[model samples]
Target: MATVESVKTKDKKREKYIVTTMKRLFKNKLAIVGLVIVILQIILALFAPFMTAHDPAAQNLANRELPVFSDGHWLGTDNYGRDVWSRIVFGARISLVVGITAVSLGLIGGTILGLLAGYYRKLDAIIMRFVDLLFSFPGILLAMLIIAILGTSLVNVAIAISIWSIPTCARIVRGSVLSIKEKEYIMAMRSMGASDLRIMIRHILPNASAPIIVFATMRMATAILSTAALSYLGLGAQPPTPEWGAMISQGQDFMWSAPHLTIVPGIAIMLTVFAFNVLGDGLRDALDPNMDLQE
Candidate 1:
C-alpha cells in the first residue's frame, strides 16, 4: 500500500510540473484587458476599408470642424471635415507597419552584431565601442538626427527608428550571450569540436532567446511612439495618409472646436502603448519562472 501511495504521489508531482509548464499566458486580468484592446486595434486596421463608411482622406471644407456626436459624422470631423474615427482606424495600419518593420530591422541587425561580439572576444572591443557611441545619444535624439539626415518620409522614419533601436537590442543580446556562452552545455558543445557557427546558432542562441524576446516586444511599443513623434514633426507619413501623428497635428488648430481629433488619436496612442507594455510585462513574467515566484 505504501509503494502504491508513493507511486501516486510521484504521478501528482509530474502532473503539477506539466501544468505549470503549460500554464495559460496573459491570463492576468490586466494582461487580458490589454490583449483585447490590442486585438480591437488590429481588427480596425485590417478592416478599415470595409468597416468605415467615409473615405479617410476625403475633405470637405464646408463641413469642417464639426463637433463630436453631430451630423452623419460620428466622432466629428477634423479640420478638413475628414472623419476623425475613420482616420484613426486607417492610421492603425501605418503605426503597426512602422512598429513591426522597424523592430524587425533592429532585431536582425542587432542580433547579428551581438552574436558575433559575444562569440569572439577579439571583436568585442570594436563592437562595444560602436554600441557605446550609439548609447551616448538618447534614443529619440538619435532617431531625430537620423531623420534630419535622411529627410522626412515613411521609409526614412522607419530607418531612423531602427537605427536608434539597434543599439539597445544589441546590448541586451550581448548580455544574454555572455551568460549563455559560459554555460556547461556550451562548453560541452565546444569540447565536441563543433564549428563556431554551429555552436552559436545551435547552442548559444536558443539559451539567450528569452531576454531578446522581451526586448523585441518592448521595442515595438517604442517604435510606435517614435514613428508618431516623427509624424507629428512632419517627418513621417505625410498628410492625407491618416497617420495618428499627422492627424493630431492637423487637429491641433481646432483644439477648442473639434477636440475629438486630438483626443481620439491621443487615446489610440496611449491605449496601444499601454497594451504593448502590459503584454510585454506579462510575457516576461510568463517566460521566466523565477519572476513568477518572486512576485
Candidate 2:
C-alpha cells in the first residue's frame, strides 16, 4: 500500500514538472520560432521523396542556372543542373543523420566516462589527462585529423565529429557529476549499501542530467556546422551527394554569375544552426524555473 501510494505521488510530481516545463518553454517567443523552424525542416527531410518528383542528382546542363523560383525547379538549379530545392530537402536527411548520430555517440560515451571519473579519484586523473590532450588541438582541427586518418565518407564524417565532441561532453558531464555526487541523496544511496556504479547511475546522473541535456542541444548545432564545414572542405560527403556544404562548395565558383546556389544552401545552414542555438537557450531557461521569464 505504501509503495503504491509513493509511486502515485511520484507520478503526479513528474506530470506537474512536464506541464510546467511546457508552459515555460512555450512562453519564450524565440524558442517557439526555433521549434517551428526545426520541425518544418524535419518534416521536409522526412517527406523529401513525396515533396519533390525531381531527382536531386538528376542533371540537365541545358537548364543550368535557370534562376530561383523558376518553372518546376522552384529555387533554381545548381551548376550541375540538379534541383536546388530537391537537394536541400534530401540534404537535410544526411545532415541531421550525421549530426544527431555523432552527438549521441559523444554524449553516451562522455556521460559514462564522466560518471566514472567523478565517482572514482584514481580514474578521474587519467580520464581528465586524456581529455586535456585532446583539447590541445582546436575542435575542427581534431576532427580534420581524425577524418584524415579514417578517410572521407558519410560514416567517417559522423565519427570525426564525435571524436572532438566526446571531450567537451566529458568535461561538462564530469563537472555536473562532481557537484551531484556530493549531494545528500548520493550519500544516502552510498550509506544504504548501493554499489558505486549503482549510486552514480541511479542518483548522481539523474541530478546531473539537466546540464547534459542542455549541452547536448547546443552541441548538436556545432556538430551540424562542423559536418557542413568538413563537407565544404572536401573531407566529408563526396561530390553529387548534395550535402549543403558540398553544394555551397560547388556553387562557390559561380558566385558572380549565379549566386542562388550558394545563397540557398548557406541560408539553410544558417537557419539550422540558429534554430538549435535558440532552442538550446530556451531549454536552459525552461529547465530553470527560477529564471525570470518576464525579462
Candidate 3:
C-alpha cells in the first residue's frame, strides 16, 4: 500500500511538472506560433490523403506549370503537372519521418555512449576520442560523405543524418552525465550499492533529460533541413517522389516562368525548420530554472 501510494504521489508530481512546463511554453508568442505550425504540419502529414484530392505522384502534361491558385489545383501545378499542394502535404510525412527517426536513433546511441563514458572512468578517453573524431568534420560534409558511400535514397539520408547527429548528442549527454554523476543523491545511490546501470538509467538519465529534449527538438530542425538539402542535391528522395527538395530541384529549371515550383516547396521547408527552431528555443528557456516565465 505504501509503495502504491508513493508511486501515485510521484505520478502526480510528474503531471504537475508537465503542466507547469506547458504553461511556461505557451506564454511565449513565438513558441505558440511554432507549436501551431508544428501541429499543423503533423496533421497534414498524418491525414495527407484527406487533406488533398490529387495524387502526388500522378502526372498530367495538360496541367503542367499552372500558376498558383489554379482552378482545381489549389497552390498550383508543378512542371510535371502534379498538384504542388498535394505533393507539399505529402512531403511533410517524408520530412518529419526522416527527421524524427534520425534524431531518435542518434539520441539512443548517443545516450548509451554518454552514459558509458561518463559513468565508467576507464571508457571516457576512448569514447570521447571517437566523438572528437566525428566532431572534426563539419556536419553537412560528414552527412554528404556518408551519403556518397551509402548511395542516394531517403533511408540512406536518414542514416547519414543520424550518424552526423550522434557525436553532438553524445557530447551533450556526456556533459550532463558528468555534472549529474557527482551529485549527493548519486553518491548516496553508490553508497547504497545500487547497480551502476540502475543508477544511470533510473536516476541520472532522467535528470539529464531536459538538455536532451531541447537538443532533440533543435536537431529536428537541422535534420529536416539536411534532408531537404540532400534531396535537392540529388542524393535523397528521387524524382516523382514529391519530396520538397527533389521538387525544388525539378522546378529550378522553370525559375523565371514558373517560380512557384521552387518557391512553394522552399517556403514549406523554411516554415517547418523555423517552427522547430522557435519551439526548441522556447523549450530550452522553459526548462531553464533561471529563466523567467510570464505570469
TM-score between model 3 and native = 0.95
**Model 3, residue 87: C-alpha shift (Å):** 0.6
Q: In angstroms, how far off is 22's CA in candidate 1? A: 6.1
Model 2 misplacement above 4 A: 292-295
Residues 170-261, candidate 1: write the lDDT tens digits.
88888888888999978987898999999988778877787888788778789888898889988888878999888888888878777788
Candidates arranged by TM-score, highest first? 2, 3, 1
The global Cα lDDT (0 to 1) of model 1 is 0.84
Candidate 1 residue 70 Cα shift, in angstroms, is 2.9
| 122-219 per-residue lDDT for model 2 (tens digits) | 99999999989998999999999998999998899899888788888888889988888888868887888999878877778887887888888888
Task: Report clash pairs, candidate 2.
Answer: none
Q: What is the lDDT, from 0 to 100, of the residue 264 in candidate 2?
A: 93
Task: Please report, in order, the local distance difference test score of every candidate based on alpha carbons.
Answer: 0.84, 0.89, 0.93
lDDT for 200 in candidate 3 is 97
Encode model 3's per-residue lDDT on 154-191: one tens digit a residue: 99999999999999898899999999999998999999
